[model samples]
Target: MTEHRPVNITGLALKIPPALIFILWIAMMATLRYIFPGLNYELFLTPYVVGLFFILGIFLVLAGFFSFRKAKTTINPRKPEKTTAIVTSGIFRLSRNPMYLGFLMWVIAWAFMQANLVTFVFLPLFVFYMNRYQIIPEEKILLSQFGDIYYRYLNKVGRWL
Candidate 1:
């Protein structure tokens, strides 16, 4: 008999809330841009912020890519059900949530390039969502599947280092 694991309530809340917030953020930004024709809020291209965001985004994407490749795992958070291996190498050694880290970096880049204060809303929301849904639930499954090996790895690596 196949055992059906129930969905996590926090995970559900996390996933839906940020998705809606992200959509709202996009809508609001588009509306504001339409209303104010001269307002140029480029989070990634902003003066000094440009360098920071560009570096961050590149670092995160590369880190996550290498880790996912090393583990031979999918980095998609929406489809964690398909993960074939536990990634604990490269950037994974530094952070347990490299994909989320990459997303965060992207958000930071968005905030800088857009230079819109409102875009900041999605930053924290994204982190909250990943922490609640992706990281926590995936950790549970990994602990259950990999046993003490996973725990040892967890001990060695910080969740968001």
Candidate 2:
């Protein structure tokens, strides 16, 4: 008989598409601000910070998307086994997960826009969830699928730059 792996009873592992999760985080952040209006705080140069982060967010996202397109590889995050090639071009040179990084930047931008100190809490939570549920799982699949080739690439690149 073939080997069978244990599965997550919650059916969450490697199941939810990361974009959906990102959008969920955005919604949650906005909801937190709504629930606690007084949580809003002020910072110096909020507009400039928001502008810089938002632009950087979108830029990294598009760069990562296009890099995958140029490489003609899979962009599906929920299914890492679908990946056809190791992308090491463009933004991938700087970050192994630029799209995720962009999503994080967008979260920071949203937090600034809300000016809610409570909203800022989601930053670390976002990183934690993504790292635990998404990145680590993806890394395992890529490592298994690509073997030593991907291992070397992993050594050379940071997960988020």
Candidate 3:
């Protein structure tokens, strides 16, 4: 029915690995917090944490929204669609995946501003999951759809950065 024979792993499994990685990362973060309550090593909870995250998160959200708006097809993950345009403007210039980046900002904001150990777990987990399952699969689709142009962009810009 499709052009290429589907790979051994289903999309569901591809999606779950990253989520699991994130979950494990969160667990580790929880252990760290539980074991050492006074640790502020990776915690970026300055006075600016609240406002900084607020502004940054908002920007990220807007960027993602704009990217989706500019994109040729739907952002729905269940149904894969070919993207006609390479969005290099607005937030796309900043981060390849602004929406997911926004989600990351939310995780960091929730963790630091609220000083909640449990919520903080989502930050790392989200990165792991998105990078492994979501971003990886999306890249494959993008490459297949965009071909050389997509590869050129991949070389020019990073996945997250």
The candidate that achieves the highest TM-score relative to the unseen native structure = 2
Please give the lDDT score at residue 5 for candidate 1: 49
Q: Write the per-residue lDDT of candidate 1 for residues 92-132, one digit (tens) a residue.
A: 77887665565566566656666656556667776776677
Residue-level lDDT tens digits of model 3 in 51-156? 7876787888777766777775555543333455667777777677776676566557556754545656567667776777678777777666667776777887
Ranking by lDDT: 2, 1, 3
Model 3: CA > 4 A from native? 1-47, 80-82, 116-121
**Top candidate by lDDT:** 2
List of clashing residue pairs for candidate 2: none
Error of 1 at 158 (Å): 2.0
Which of 1 and 3 is ahead in lDDT? 1
TM-score per candidate: 0.67, 0.90, 0.68
After TM-score superposition, the amount by which residue 13's alpha carbon in candidate 1 deviates from its true location, in angstroms, is: 7.2
Number of colliding residue pairs in each model: 12, 0, 2
What's the CA error at residue 155 for candidate 2, in Å? 1.0
